[model samples]
Target: MNWQQAQKDFEHFLLIERGLAKNSVQNYSLDISKLINHLSTNEIRVSPTKITGEILQHFIYEVAKILNARSQSRIISGLKSFFNYLIFEGYRDDNPMELIESPKTGRKLPDTLSLNEIDDLIAAVDLSTNEGERNRAIIETLYGCGLRVSEVIDLNISDLYFQEGFIKITGKGDKERFVPIGEITQNYITQYLENSRNRVSVKKLASDVVFLNRRGNKLTRAMIFTIVKNLALTANLNKNISPHTFRHSFATHLLENGADLRAIQQMLGHESITTTEIYMHVDKSHLREVIKDFHPRSNY
Candidate 1:
């Protein structure tokens, strides 16, 4: 099959079969496009089913000059998944990427914001304007509930259980989970709902959406990132931050305060406890405290 048709089929497979998020699917698509670009630039005309690991290795070698180990690894991983799909569909015999080795890249810890930094970022929001209330609520939900940007944007008015002190989040792959909301976060969201959001004229489809644009449609993920970026600039904080920095800070802060990792995992909707365990590494002092407080023979 031609590169275009192969990529189109791969995209459909990822979305329909694997149920990957849009950004994730886009990343996989980008990797295949890069490979196609490499083949075209080198004047190597080869079909997807006929391409060998040797040509892929050559492409990897060229990419290694510009991409770091982590990026190279991700590209290799994406390509492998794509070709594996081809194999599963009976479009090819043996997987061409079977023998290809991904470059070794160590686990990179996510960046987290300090409590003071998070506070300053929220404090920087202009509360006088109509959108200001909405912005504050967005930050609070992100930090308080550890909601991903997509989850926050997709939040519905029906999903809020204020009396229960929890918010329902639709996470990756359509997984649903309940996350507890703090009093402060609840208050901010309530105020935004009662005041700013009430003023907006919402679209029919987005009537149940909690956060909305001025025109009352569901907010884009990019808008949330832009909000965080502007707030960072207004706060004059030097660290580069995003909506995710708040989520990381949420888990990290909870772990530092002796909250159970499993509980945090449930709230964050992480499928694996290993994903939640990264917070344990964030605060070594907490680990030392756990040893001193709980371990037997600590006095010795």
Candidate 2:
């Protein structure tokens, strides 16, 4: 089959059989497209089933010259998954990326905000306007629930179980998890819905959506980023902050406050404890406190 057909089938598998999010599938497709573009540009004649490791290596080398280590690593990883999928479908006998190695980019720690900084950020939200109330609720839900930006945007009014103190989040691959919502977050949401959201003429498509734009439509991811950026500027936060910073802060703060790692994993809807363990490195003092308070040898 041609490279186009191969990539199409691979994308279908990623989206349908693998249940990957659209963004993830698009990334995988883009990786394959880069390879396809390289072959066309260089006038190389090889189908996906017949492509050799040498060609892939040359492509990766070209990529390394243009991209950083992290980006090159991601493309390599993405290509590896595509070839593996071809093998799984009996289109190829051997994987091309088996000998390839990713560059050693050490553990990149997530940036977190201290409690005082978080308070200041939230305080920066202007309460004089209806949209400000919605923005405040958006920020609160993000930090309070440890939700990914995507989850916050996809949240619906039906997901809020305020009486049970939980908000249902639809995370990556459409996996659903109920994370506990604190009273403060619940109150903020309640106020937004009752006062601001109730006043807006919501679009039918976005009627059930929890967060809406000025047009009463669902808020876009870019809008969320803009909101966070403006808030950071207003708060005079020196750190490069995003909506994700709040999520990192949520996990780090919980871990530092003696919350169980497994429990934090559940709350964050992380598929693995290893993913949650990154927060352990965010605060070394928390580890010291754990050892001092709980280690049997601490009595000495």
Candidate 3:
């Protein structure tokens, strides 16, 4: 098969068989496209099935000259997955990336917003406008539920079980989890819906969507980033912040407040406790306290 056909089929496999989210599929596709670009620019003729480890090494070497260790490692990892998929589909017998090694990039900690900083950012919104109320709800839900930005955008009115004090979130890989919603978050969302959302002329089939742009369509991920960036500027905050920052803060605050690590994992919809363990490094005191309260030898 041709390169384009191979790319398309791989994406289909990732989406259907692997159950990866759209963004993940796109990232994988992008990695393949980079290889295609490398081959084209060098006037080298090769097919995906015919590409050897040597050629991939050459491409990665070229990539390393321009990309950081983190980026190079990511592309290498992506290409490894791509070739593995080909092997799984009977397109090849051996894995090309088996001998390849990824760079040792140490654990990158997530940035978090302090509670006062979060409040200031929320206060920066222009409340006179209808969009302000919607933005407030957006920020609150993000921080309160520890939701990924995508989760917040794809949220629907039907997903909210306000009475039950929980909201259903469709996370990465289309996995669904019900996260508890606090009274503050529920109240802000309800206020937005009653005062602001009721006025929107929502587009067809977007009626059930909880967040809408000024054009009455579901908000895009870029829009969420812009909202956060603009708010950061207005608040005069020196730190880089994003919707994910709220999620990190949510987890951090919960840990600092003596919430269980497993409970925080459940609230964040993380599939693995290891993923949630990163927060443990953010507060050494919490770790010490855990040992203090639970370790049998600590009683002495």
Best by TM-score: 3
Each prediction's Cα lDDT score? 0.91, 0.92, 0.92
- Across residues 81-166, which tens digit of lDDT does each residue of candidate 3 receive? 98888889888888787788887888999898889999999899999987999999999999999999999999999999999999
Candidates by TM-score, descending order:
3, 2, 1
Q: Candidate 1, after superposition: displacement of residue 289 in Å? A: 1.2
lDDT (tens digit, per residue) of candidate 2 on 1-300: 999999999999998999998888999999999999999999999999899999999999999999988988999999999999989999999999989898877889999999899889889999998798999999999999999898998999999999998888888888899899999999999999999998899999999999998889999889999999999999999999889999999999988888999999999988999999999888788788778999999989
What TM-score would candidate 1 get against the native? Answer: 0.93
Residue 115 of model 3 has an lDDT of: 94
In candidate 3, stretches whose alpha carbon ends up further than 4 angstroms from where it belongs are 290-300
What shift in Å separates residue 28 of candidate 3 from its native position after superposition? 0.9
lDDT by residue for model 1 (1-300), tens = 799999999998888888887778899999999999999999999999999989999999999999999999999999999888888999888878878888788787889998888899889999998799999999999999998998999999999998998888888878789889989999999999999999999999999999999998999989999999999999999988889988999999998998888999999999999999987777689788888999998869
Q: Residue 116 error for model 3, in Å?
A: 1.0
Instruction: Report backbone clashes per prediction.
Output: 0, 0, 0
Cα-based lDDT at residue 7, candidate 1: 100
